[model samples]
Target: MKIKIPTHEDYQSHDGLHYYQLWNSIGDEWLCPACGRSKFQIMKWTQRFPNTPHSFMGWVAALHKHHDHSIGFFEPGQTRFPETLICGQCNSTDGVVKRMLNLPSNFSFSPQEMRTFIQATPHGKHKINYDQALEIFNLRATNKNGIPKVY
Candidate 1:
């Protein structure tokens, strides 16, 4: 199934912000805009301060799902590119896969670092493996902030 691709005019009319608001406001369940799938997921990444491991990431994507349509709060000051909107099923395609091929390797967090992170926040107490932390960290690192770049 194909997703509705917004036109340039759509972006201009809203000054590039309305679409996100509209998507977030959908009350009833809607099909995935990318694959027409009924199932949708919410993804989130957090940036923690080294000193306290507190989420220094400010209010961000708080009102809406991640650009990927995953439901979760995103790091403040991070931007979501158009590529993020692609569903997981579609992400493996040749051209789309290449877009993420250049993503940097996950940041390595030492055991000590993990401990420090866990100690800083209430939610940190939950068991989170290194891979999981690394994935979120990477997403936080790569995400762009403000209006998504139109390509």
Candidate 2:
């Protein structure tokens, strides 16, 4: 069977994603667009989850329907859909990074936008790490307004 590469349209979720469709569209091999990590990699990483009795289940549970939080919050179990699938870690890190960099709350890096920020090195695939985000912040900070703490 020919693999049908999913368009951006396919990933937009309003109600929620169908896991079966994800298995079919991207298969077992697709990487998370935000950090370029694969599901298996995320699963292995989740094995060492420091907190929670359901640690082993973290892998499946980590697959989050990451959406625009600026859109407003939904009540628990209220079927908040996705902009795309990102591991729980990346989704949380987005918050951390925004705070660290003082980016606007609504500001977010889209998958393709995020791709530009990641650094590819010979040391295998890594997340769009904090260092990368820091570098970007430094460049923009120096060029635009100049950070107070930074020279």
Which has the greatest lDDT?
Answer: 2
Clashing pairs in 1: 41-70, 42-70, 42-71, 43-70, 78-144, 78-145, 79-144, 79-145
Output the worst ten-in-a-row residue range by lDDT, candidate 2. Answer: 8-17
Candidate lDDT scores, in order, read: 0.31, 0.50
Give the per-residue lDDT digits (tens) of candidate 2, residues 44-149. 2124335767555222314555776534322334323349876555666667778877776754554544556654321133345666676654443353356433
lDDT by residue (tens digit), candidate 1, 1-151: 2323334343233321234554455432544343333222211123434468464742111122223322232433433333233222233221222233443222222222233222121111123344444454454445466343221
Q: Given candidate 1, what's the lDDT at residue 99?
A: 38
Superposed model 1: Cα runs more than 4 Å off: 1-19, 35-40, 43-45, 48-96, 100-151
TM-score of 2: 0.46
Model 1, position 79: C-alpha lDDT score? 32
For candidate 2, give the lDDT of residue 43: 37
lDDT of 2 at 146: 61
